[model samples]
Target chain A: MKTLKYITLFAAISTSLLFVQCKDDDDNVITQETCTDGIMNGEETGVDCGGPDCQPCGLVLDFSGTYIQEDQMGRPGINTVFGTEGFKDAFNVTVPSQMQAAFQEKFETKLLGLNPAYTSNALGLDASTFTTVLSNDVLWLAQSGVTTYFNGTEILTGRALSDDVIDVSLLLIFGGPMGDQNPGLTSDGVPTNDAAFSNSFPYLAGPF
Target chain B: MKKSKLFAVIGGIGLAVLSIFLISADHIDAPAVQGTTADITDFYAFQGQNTSNFVFIANVQGLLSPGQPTDEAVFDETVLLEFNIDYNNDLNEDLVIQAIKRGDSMYFFGPTAPAFSGEEGTKSTIATSTRRSVKISTRDDVQIAEQDGMKFFAGPREDPFFFDFNQYNAVLSGTASSFNNPGMDTFAGTNVLSVVVEFPKSMLPGGTTGVNQFAPSTPMYNVWVEAKRKQ
Candidate 1:
């Protein structure tokens, strides 16, 4: 009985010492992986900035002084086809609310310059109304309906990953009511993505 | 704990804060910002698998070669990616979803209410009252996270846009009237950095909406993505 009691006491002592040794490391166990605790813990250089949990300061582009306009894409060719180089910066920097007023005439002129025939599109939206929509520069989405850039039935009701937006835009801009006017000029030909997209959340395809 | 229920990733852009805006589509345009992190190749918005949910995607840095190693890229830390939603047909975002990348995690904030709205958006210095983050997946493995009824994912994804730029330029140059039946896929065999988010439709403010394309006063939801640098 004495021997047994001694062994049990020794085991208990050993376990307590191990716990004591690990006390400091245990503090980080709960917080090591967390980034937004508002406290700069772990290897983070700033408050929730730097280290593994957040992007390091080194990787960020240095835009310290001027916040110049970089790039903009809402509908496929709004800026590329419509906005002139002189107006590109203006169009890009212009807020959507103020876009149409500033760029509608320019957009119409560009449209007429491109097609020349200059009539209503298949959607029945004339140059003024159509340019108005494009000038706002935003992808319109429907909450409870089929999602596509344009599917003959629904127009500009959000876009799916597989929607041939370029084709639709071409048909509207170059093709007439029956969509056969500029059949040759309508499609860019390349269809579908290089790979298959995921069916679940983040629905993008795996990088090649 | 608290991080799971409430945290915000204010995707920082620009000089000190980055703001990414998606307005037009072009592979290699924008002379100043071409091939940089501000280069937004494409932006997509769609209804989620559940009709009540919505998904927003912003793809940047197009033509990252499929097999090229000299081209590894990251979501510029100095940049902030913001999705602007105009639910009232006003052409301004009433609500914004901001995404920022840190380390190997992507943080998202506010399909909440907009604290700031305009052309050059100043990222709120306030940490997202609600914070949610997901692990950044690599090429070998993918990462996803679900929290507060929203799902998030970030990292490299295959480029899904299909277009024949050669044929397109040909038509534009007046050499052709239209285009070929099956033009070559120029974007094939390439990859892009994608940040994706899916959330409840109700999260965005909308009540009076459009009945059809011809309807007036219909709440047309206008969405665009932006990359802004901190000033």
Candidate 2:
């Protein structure tokens, strides 16, 4: 019995010592991996990553993935008038080349829905042709021309800062072939911007 | 445990500050970008005063109230402003000029070829050869930077798009038959972050002769602007 007791005590003592040694090892490990330390110390490939204790570094290039397109605008108010809630988000992201094929029919449906009497606009295009043009929401500019949005004779060459686009849009949508169909519906009474546009480079008026 | 709790508090405060800078609701069409820096209000392209050059203007963060502090309405550095030019009329961006704000200045890259363009969106990479950097204007004095005959400006400007939004909404809703005489200009007192660029027509495709010409073979360019954020 005495010998058995001595054996049991020795075993217990050995196990306790092993446990103490393991705790010391854990303390050493904690000291070794200080990933939170901003310095690129230890085994870090980047500041804190690519080490055994932290995640790996991808080594992304500067301005490599700089920005993503969250919004696209070609022509003003094309998506706003035609695209409803669910459709608006998709239309904004749709590539201009694919826009006609993807959204032309829907645009036609909305256009007709807006003006049931839309036989044709000032552009002399029928519903089908107009919607096809509108669906590809890119602003076309002539490389050489008197650049104006719509100056009675010139149309859609390019937009001048002073061009009354909203009035023109209203006239095109509501006006008949002669562009005088609904006098009331056409031309939002606001003719000019509150502030005058500068005639120089960076033509927009300075902010108040 | 204490360190982790401290990190959590700091993270929460960071997010709160970011959210305050982010909430901008302006453009009517794009619900996704409406309340963010990605909202594009208007785009204008025209013949420059130096008729040999063409001017392209893009406006974002529309309808900023005049009463609001200037710092609150400044351009978001996270958003990338891009002007896409389709010289071939393929409805694809053959060339693009990109601008982004960094530390009170706007950096520009490329009248060069885009890294990629489509519905997949553009991964903007700075073109080292054609890069230009300009100071961003904050006050009434307009700041412009000119280099190698290319002129650039990024700043706040009056919301130039005049619209009777309330009347239009009424008309669309079928509640009104027509817009009123002298309709309210919804964008009158508002401001927008504006980026303007003017470069010689010779820089475009097929104009390599370095002279502005109306040759029939010269392509009519389709232009557009996009506001992008880092993914």
Candidate 3:
């Protein structure tokens, strides 16, 4: 009976000691909150040298090219007087062969050219027998627009869907007429003059 | 017999716990220099005209505000900048050009072979015959009217990359309807560290033989730069 009692006492003490040591060890394990500001040691303060408050690092990989155009006073005019026919001619878009075929199949008319007369009426222009020579000039400007290519890739072939090209086309026609047709007008009311193109490619001559 | 067996089991558990603690202590004590390094921002190599010379640039201390330009904040004196050149066909650096800054001025040390790789503490400066030294110039090359040849600058400059970050974030969050037609530019006005080096084309193995070359061009060369922080 005495041996049995001693054995029980030994088992209880050993188990209690193991439980206490394990609990102490678990408590010492480092957690994120316990680490000082995410820094593991005093020698290194933060992930970055200046700490978390430091401004983000900057890297510039490809920095090249130059802008060409820069004359504000001699800026070109945009020609917006073009009706649908004028838009098609000025843009010089060769509809993708598939799109052309699809459009023809749907319309059932050989849509060879877009008609300016319909576009003029659609835009609510004064098409009531208004045969002004300036209007004709504006129409001509829209019909014959220039195309620009970058690195042999036709970025803006003729003048389809180009805000800058369209704006310049309108400016070329209207810029000269600003003071005459509309009195007290210095230039086109729109602010087409900006440094976006200039800063990118400095060697280029002009946006127009 | 059962009592002796129980004692042995307890002793084994104690040894296991002690071993775990000893192993973890070593990981907690990694050296500082290996722990705190960062990516390099810019690397430049170009030739100077009028002289048969070249310049090399490697910049660090990136994205600093205009206000922080003159602060005591400088390159860590201990950190080394190495310019590795593969004079032979192999990718390993056969020649190296190194620079370190001291008190507002930068000092160029060599185009020498590395004595040690991935280890700390400066090794013996390789033979004097293979080393050349130059002091950094104060003029900003961006503003300089003419660089007849000999010039080197490595420091912070306005970032020249253009990306529309706000639009990108908005798109990622599903709040934006669609990306702008031409897209927005987020990096329009920022800064980065720049390193510029200019050397004569002749000094290289192939001196502009053809407009383009096929092999990594030891004789004829195209160069790119990188910064390696000690891992």
TM-score of chain A of each: 0.67, 0.68, 0.19
Off by over 4 Å in 3: A1-208, B1-38, B45-55, B69-72, B116-149, B165-185, B207-219, B222-231
Better structure of 1 and 2 per lDDT = 2
Compose the digit string of candidate 2's lDDT tens values, residues B131-225.
67677887556678887789999988888888787776555444566789989987888888889999988888752221112223334678888
DockQ in order: 0.28, 0.24, 0.01
TM-score, every prediction: 0.77, 0.76, 0.35
Locate the minimum summed-lDDT window of 10 residues in model 3 chain A. Answer: A67-76
In CAPRI terms, model 1 is classed as acceptable
Q: Encode model 1's per-residue lDDT on A10-82: one tens digit a residue.
A: 6666667775754333333344544565555568887566886565655552222333345666777677667
TM-score of chain B of each: 0.80, 0.79, 0.54
Per-residue error (Å), model 2, residue A12: 80
The per-residue C-alpha lDDT of model 3 at residue A19 equals: 52
Candidate 2, residues A153-184: lDDT per residue as tens digits? 67777789888888887787767778877687
Docking quality (DockQ) of candidate 1: 0.28
